[model samples]
Target: MKFKISTGACFIFFSGLYSNLLLPAMELQAQNINIPIVSQHNALVLQVDGNKNLSTIYFGKKLLDQAEYNNIPELYKQGTDYTGILNAAYTPSGSRNLLEPAITVTHADGNNSLDLRYVSHTITQVNDDVSLFSVVLKDPVYNFLVTLYYKSYFREDVLEQWSVIENKEKGAVILQKFASANLYLKAGSYWLNQYHGDWAKEMQPEESRLTHGIKTLDSKLGTRTNLFQPSVFMISLDKPASEDEGTVLYGALEYSGNFRTDLELDYQNNLKIISGINNYSSAYTLKPNEVFTTPAFLYTLSFTGKGNASRKLHQWARNYQLLAGKGNRLTLLNNWESTYFDFNENKLAALLKDTKKLGVDMFLLDDGWFANKYPRNDDHAGLGDWQENKQKLPNGIASLVKEANNNGVKFGIWLEPEMVNPKSELYEKHPDWVIKQPGREEYYFRNQLVLDVSNPQVQEFIYGTIDGLLTKNPDLAYIKWDCNAVIYNAYSAHLKNQSHFYIEYMRGLYKVLESIRAKYPKVPMMLCSGGGGRVDYAALQYFTEFWPSDNTDPLERIFIQWEYSYFYPAITSSNHVTDWGKQSLKFRTDVAMMGKLGFDIVVSRLSDHDLQFCKEAIKTYNAIKPKIWQGDQYRLSDPRAGSIASVLYVNEDQSSAVIFNYLVNNRYNEGSKMPVLLKGLDPVKKYTIKEVNLYPGTVSTIDALKVYSGDFLMKAGFNPDVNAERPSVVLEVNEVH
Candidate 1:
């Protein structure tokens, strides 16, 4: 058999014997081949030995020349490990390999061992910026096949990998464990950076040093999978991790269901990373001729530190994963915090008027507009019934949409279709629609039960719910799709075996989302699982932005946004000003402007001075929205390290920039003066800096007329006057013509 390898415009062919069993060691030695998947800045080289065993030979900075591959074997010679454990590219359970396997299966005839050997390979150029390389492997003893796929985003320095496992045996094969990708790195002292938080507080960065054991980050919440984000950064301690100067390896799983990422530092100092769907209570049974594919694991290797790695991932996401891409996101006013559940048509009309008066782009009617029988007056009832409450809306949702549009403001609504409260009309009619184990009492979370999305009927119902809303009101500008509860008593009556609940549920959710996206392609949607719960690439592909946290307090948001920016771009982060904290209006607006700016406060209730400040802040945010959404982000200071946090954003052409400085707390005797160093600016360009969005009586921090060279601003950074009264400032820098 001939295997064709294509690296860019170059192609090579090599001959190998096709077999169902492992070839003899001597015969296989001559057929060994090295495959290199090259990106713009990195290369991942895989070696298939004569015995058909595949392993990673090298994965790091790009090779200068193809000839450099010849020395890799000699540089890292094979060891004498008789147990057949040498960082096999895609390890399977069996063959005396003791390390964690990427795949574990129980085959027919009660045989549970699997030893996959390389069968064939192919490479295809997907586009100018992307390429796909696939390798097929099969267990010599069983009619089982596993195809590993690697897709390289060449220009973005990002690689995505996933596995497809097919069962060709007569009887059903049970798959106990399956990982999307496995990577092995040479022994080194490494530090792992991960994000951990709860519902109202998400994306809190935590760093730890790796030791000689297994370190795992996983989430089994089933639905709100991001309680522990399915992403991490590993940096070598040799070159300490900094914003822009270190070797950083980032891996993020695209799955939104139960997921796990394991980092193992073995006795030999070798490191292994296994990331994909969590195997806890999710053993899938594959029938004859059936195939199961894992979610894609996205990764990038950066030699220039966490910032570079983040930019690469962000570029790739905008190019492919995110639905909104680099487009502008709308700034809206969400009414959840404004009115909670007590509002009528007159109240909503007043909010709509405020939305237009305040120059907000959209007015969102959140949570209380739905349901007729149960009234939806609080969190306890009216979840599953997707209808307008006559008492609240009076004239219905179409009227509200018309009113907002007539006022030159867009309209949006919120729906939690994947959840149903026990007091809801839909739940009362169909109790079996929820996920509950047979003959067991159901567990309630937030007074609601998780809809059995794994059931086809439930999927259809969810699709219909959104479809009805969009169809009835075509002018509805946005949607806030929420899933407020996690799966409990997880059992899928639609499935014969209950172990497939998590995987099937995710599949079902995706199916509904796909259907919706296909129809309402232009409608922008926001994914919110009580805030940051559904923050994964799989869901982001369909939504425009996400609520980073339910805690809209400016101080808490400073930390949340800082950590979130390390992976997700600002365009996808929906930050809103609220009345939840003691921060002043200017402080709240300055913090929210760092991301896609919005508001969740009752505008009419604001003091006259504060109301005028909101109008001016909205105007300023609109003027600089492009720089914040599409510019390169530089985190100048970390809130965790000090009492102040700062961030800078510079446009692509270096024509414009914005800096946000936030003071977390007031120090009694110390002066509130700190240097704000800039990054990603043209050293030769002279720019004018001005403080924007200042309240009527607030003190100014910038001259608003002085021009300074970028080099001077970066080297001799300017000091901002951040005091207790004015705890934050937004500096706008425009290149002087």
Candidate 2:
């Protein structure tokens, strides 16, 4: 049942279902409470609990925060209560239960749950940092934590990010902010990590807030996902550092999540986990009719140095809330190489054998697996044909799906339904179905033509093709939907005019996606352009992940990805470890872990020593992936400023943090010092720091690690003979809180 906690000045409301119930007291002193409310109405708090707290659900009505769109007020609440209820029956306009706006609460001691739905909960924000609401339920469940944060209306311009201090010994503040506009600044070692794939920051020449860009053979245009505001939300886990030191900051904007059908846009479910210096925040989800109960420890900071500590913390968290917040974890390894050329079953099976052993969870088939004569090796050959290449695989698509499943790995496929090739049977049979200028020469990229999804016939065909594939093979787990070419000679036969085709085409694509998702809700999909070509926020509503770039070089990625992280979630970006590099295995492996760690290089190519190292790297990554993807990201150094150092660390559950430090330059000089102080960790916990790959034998005791209010000395200096280009060190510390 829904529960509301009010203390005259502070109000808390929760909704969701769970089996356990514990009416805990508001145990905090009055001075420690502050609620960040997004609106005056619909500000109720809700929570959901399940067995062992597998997921904690938090939900509430959020008002959209928009400064650019003129129709903000109109769009704010227009659909907040819209239950997709239409003319189902005749009823008075003022009084109708068609919507059934109610909060549901489910509880189970361990396995059995009682669900309670409450339709009446009036919510109001009493002040800027406090809100009050009330809910009535027949029974209540306890032992669940409740919290109230912003769940604002969707905005296209901005993104939110939450960063914690990486120091294992010292308590540091955590920073969160909603970024505004795309402009970036040379802040301290703070950098934002984002999951945006191959899209540029600059607007396309003809691209507007709505349209303009070339369409790919898959009819996937780069112009659709552009952000309304290039701004980012930021939070500081410690005292702010000087903007000058080229301290790169990492942040990301990911577009993949669980979406509900009733809401045209994905149901907004973005939040940040803020933890105090001594405690770590638990991962939770919000359920209906339950209260969002969160302990204060989830959002605390440690101060190593006393320099405007609380101010920094508030600034950080508030900034993240201001920007639209979303996140993702796990970088993926795709099989574009294995399937791109229409390899046979044996070829794929062989390729997957090595990939699975390399610690990769996902194996994505990139094109070429579908169709017979119209092999998808190139864009112009296979557009509308989503059939399997039987000649290459006598066992059919199910065999490959089953084979991958048996190997303990998830299998994914690629498809580009938005376009067609003139030579293909689909386009030849329906010449009027393509989107192009009537008289002008049809644009062809890799011999492909963009499909006019605006046509109901085309949408139906696309849907049927996908439906058939899923029905035929239930083992399909992932898809790498790629858009290879750009829209040239753009026009839609179904549109009233060419001027409206761009937006209309996008809308049609969304419609097709909506239909597809209605049937297949569990499959994960990734958006890929030529490479970071169509990166933006719009596509995020539909897709779960994105490819950062086609370039797999480690050193190059340090910069390429460093730039992209400013407004995306680090988890959505796939980092592939490839042998395409001439650098040392250490450098490459280290760089790969910076993003969602994956392998693209031939694993067999590495030496015995390298192989062992690779295996160890995988183990290390798995142990720390949660922290890297979820903890606050900070850029300790930048190559642009001639400082070849970059560091990212995740708190070690209030005990310590694992740090990946890329020393671009040699720092092997005897007694060379790189005195670094960490933040966002527990000072109360005992910690031991060691450079796992650097000083393998040395360990330092951390006694309440202090935040660096000023410059700190390095532990080591540059090596006398620097390689000029290689990642040097990786640090892993253990906290004993």
Candidate 3:
């Protein structure tokens, strides 16, 4: 192996075997080897020492000149006790470092101490705004190699990193832990912000101060990894982090399976973050010449505050991470919450008629539509059997699609392809397909067993389940893919080593998704893992949007949507108006309009007054849908801290904007007025404000005929009425040409 070092006006190449002997003599030359991975507003500089170990020198705002790299001081300690505190770019399990290791391996000779040193590096400019960098590291005494890859989206100020490990030894080695990226930050007071909740209450924000210890945020549930999302914001505590001011660093792991993120504030006060797949009961064995790759870890730094960090991620996701991201999301009406499993073909047709009358873009026949020997009247009977229930449907899914088209709307169906019920024919025929441990009883969640997707046959079955549905009904317009169970037994019968189940399952799922995407490229699919359980970037790559939660009560959703917008874009969050609570129809409609608008309520049951409100709200939402879908979002007030929640969306050109304010709760003796400051608008432009979606007798706080300058509106925010009778407002702002 050879390594290349580029210094000022000179380049030196050396063989790997002779590096140790020649390094001492050329210490000055080696110290000058700096590789700076730069994005539009941030830079991560890696330096190679005389010992060939890689260390991070700087990671913050962009440095304009190469000389700035040399001016950055490296942290040092003179005593042996503090030697392990040095921030090695990527450390292995060894005595040299006492902190958490990025990769831990036990060799064939029973030696677990392994040291990794820099070998070679390469940089490739994929485009004007994207660059890829890779560094090779290897153990001095073993034939184990790990290659770290970094990709930078310059325009978005986002960076992604992952690692690939290969073993060439004669015997197998046990991989105890493998992390995708290891990031180091200089000494500072820090605050860690994370999202955590369960089931219908997902994405609740929790912030805490970082102290002198290790903080681990992880998800142990194999499938439903959203018990706690693998993402966080580390805010520098010069002061409290707000929307527009303070330094913030954001990180998210792109894995739908079990994940772990570690934030360690070392004894020396510096911080180190290790993030990747969780290593609980998942010690993988890499055989000779075999390789394993980890999921990508994405991160970005924002000096302007947490809001800018969120925008950076949203910009990157819309442009590269999302499927059909540039396309418009449809406004759908679903039947699950309305009728559950009690609806037949005629009932669905009637719903489709109402859906058309309300001007909904599509009618989604969710769940209960597919079954055979065992009817799916409830969640207990039919899951893997993906055929239409003959008694209920009479004709088939094709007939429903035709009915939907005849009603002047599109058709969609819900499917849970990754689960099996014991009473179903598929599970009876192939009992071995379900994940279970031999000679042990299996546990079930939601009356379903997770399919062993790691098996090739299961992968093909999943793909066929989707392909057959779309192929048979060519006019089907959408799909709501859902998973409702977590791995209980956590065993794959087909794999000789059961520890690889989680990673293999994710690989199999992506393979199936890739195949379906290749065949039906235009069909929009929504990811619903029992509602927001599998909300991660890995799944979002193939899905158009995701149901943020099953709890659609507008009051609860105000807090949920506020927390969700911290990292995810509105276009990818599916919000629905359901008959779950007593909130007014207008209030529910206004809340749902903040995201991909949809309805999950029985339209025929609504009062005439409510029906008209729905019609007007949908029309108003469609008028400003373009700006809401592709725009910058500003969160004005946090719902968790108070009774009022406010959000604003501004178009790229600042020509149009929308503001939503909700009085989540009302208390006696409190004022019925809330101030909402607008953001992301052109300060010099004159704009007109209109209160939309109002009932015939309802009153609004805004004077629709009055015009205001952007400067005045932002400086002196307008107040909206927040009484018990009318608790929400949706204001439209357009530049006065």
Candidate 4:
């Protein structure tokens, strides 16, 4: 079904269809344009004119096949109407190229810069669902060549693009800015949806109308810190987007270090959005023949609104981004709040037994595991010292691991391998290994400093520490990897140009991850930036799950999950059920079910009633875990706009489903009530729905069992009493004849 532009012509099959869908590929247009083109069915079409300049043909439901061959210097001023794919310093609008430049490089002469000139392009069919479009761009003036790659998954309604910039001059070239991908769209009423947050709050979805000038989100932090993740964004140009209806252009960058997402409206009203690395220093020097490749920028357009847009992103991530595929979502329990930095072998053994009693699958020992040499009792002392704290774990982690396995729990350890404490033995021995300028005042977050991971020695230490622990403990099934601080001094001892530190830092971090994964490919890993800091498909490529935020508040988590669901899979979320102070087991468990479900509070200390609730919830979670991972996720209710939040998951085959509805707040005397419309169901079939008492005890007017047509369930909807302040209901819908 997938073919390339062989010989001289290529075929495009139209694929936008659903209720009253239109324009099937059967109604084909034999007509071909002079310019060569590549397309993903009829939904998207791309072309390059005679100048070897790329242009958009079809994006989403719009067609932009018209070519502007006439050389109008003024048109370049009117935004991206006639501008080529790559804008450069050699252009007529040099220094004022408002549109996002694909690559920025300093010329050898120091005055004469480079403009992107077309070289050649090739389309290679990689697989049935994937096609790679590679275009070569040259900055002849600077002797620089950039190879742009666009990989299209025709079936998934997704396209990813990245560029490799190579310096060909005998001397070095100074790289200023580089974007993974730049896109131009016909402009109109534009609104940008961005997920913004800080520390305990991450992925709080927010939107605003975009006006003229530029709207930007850039993260200068070493990691894709949650404070500002300029990595994923959704744009609505012509109308205010809704959950289920409206044109939405969704994009996510695959890089984790210093990123920026730029959206600008030109003088002509056209829009240009760019996603790529943030030039923290604009001093990255590239040696001749050395290539710098940008991260893959993945994007897709959905006519059916943000929900569908998110589904495509989530699907792409699960299918192609995760380190492991469709892994089990075991009921994991963490001993963080339970015993912050205070726990020993005895405490852990008791907790492990409680986890087994509650049917918890994994026991993640969070923080304070190493460095008895300098005593890592808190955040200040002992980091980077990857030795066992003999006092804390007198017997080491062997007996604990063995006991955990025997208790039917997978044992995972927490480690912050990318950071070091000045008070630790490791830092005292190798003081220069930290990321700091030689003569500048050093900065630290959480009493920890980042490692100049660019150094080969540092990378080796990190890799060995992690690989050694995993190897030593054969039963170690998971890792809670944490990076607590951002780059401060941004200097590397081995590198002269400090600007390249950001790029090399990621390279070194990724190298360490690769080394560890090569040794323990199947082990599930968690990437935590203290709690919620680092996020992006590039980091997601190595980590199995992410801690959304340290705050486990149920009401907050619903909104966080809603935003994350669009770009990341539930499996990648470390949604822990935490009884942080007054939270009940039911409310916490219900929210955690939306992600890679886990526990954080002390289990053994819980009352009998609470412990019973935990046992029952895990049993329910185990049965429906697969469906949650592989199902089509739907946001039945928006938590922000209303007091009720609801989510539905339907199996790929549509034969089974699980729905979770929670009352976010107590506003009205009456129960929080709404008709939750279901999606991704076979309307032709009948289904039996049963109300599951997942929380152990709850009051609801919803019937115990009922049979309904899928059509009725979607159109008429199911109404339940979401009255309790933290009340919730779980529905098990089965296709029954």
Candidate number of the best lDDT: 1
In candidate 2, where is summed lDDT lowest over 10 consecutive residues?
256-265
The number of residue pairs in model 1 that clash at the backbone is 1
Expressed as tens digits, the lDDT of each residue in 708-728 for candidate 1 is 999998998877666665578
* Candidate 3 lDDT over residue span 1-737, tens digit each: 11110010011122331222122223335455788899988899988777777788889888779777888763444235355436788878775888888889999888998888788787766668877777888887899988787888999999888887888899999989999899988745788888788888888777888888888989888887885564544555445577899888888888888899989887777788999889998898888988777888888888888789888988888888888777888898999888888999889989999999888899999889878899898999988899899999989999999999899999998998999998799989998899887788978899989999999999999999899998899999999999889888788879988888887888788778878988888799999987788877777888999988898888888888877787888899999998877888888888999989999988999888888888888888888887777898888766766777878889999988998878776786343355667788888999998888897677777788888889988988776665566688888888999
Please provide, for model 4 over 268-383, each residue's C-alpha lDDT reduced to its tens digit, 9 standing for 90 to 100: 77677777778767467777777777777778887788888778777777777777747665567888889999999999999999888878778888888789779889999999
lDDT score, candidate 3, position 496? 89
Between candidates 3 and 4, which one is better according to lDDT?
3
Query: How many residue pairs clash in all the candidates, one count each?
Result: 1, 157, 0, 2
The Cα local distance difference test for each model comes to 0.82, 0.44, 0.82, 0.73
Assess every candidate by TM-score: 0.94, 0.58, 0.94, 0.90
lDDT of 1 at 565: 87
- Candidate 2 local lDDT, 1-737, one digit each (tens): 12111111112323332122333333333222112223322221132212111111112223354222222224333234242212111111122223211111122322222222221223443324433333322212332222222222222111121111111112221111111001111111222211223333321111111011211101123233322222122232212323222112222232211111110111221122221111111112223333232111111112221122222322333233211123434344555543457577887787677667776676666677766677666555867777777777778778877887788877777788776777777876898898677899766766877777768888899888778878888877766676655666766667664544543455567677778767885566776765565454435444665666677766667776765554454555667776655677777777777657766655556577776777777777787776665555555455554445555554525454566655443445422133444445544454555555322222323322433221111222112112343245666556533
Clashing pairs in model 3, backbone N/Cα/C closer than 3 A: none
Residue 539 local lDDT, model 2? 54
Cα RMSD (Å) between model 2 and the true structure? Answer: 17.2
Please estimate how well model 3 matches the true structure, expressed as its whole-model Cα lDDT: 0.82
As a whole number from 0 to 100, the lDDT of residue 449 in candidate 4 is 88
Number of the candidate with higher lDDT, 1 or 3: 1
Mark the 10 consecutive residues where model 4 has the least summed lDDT. 1-10
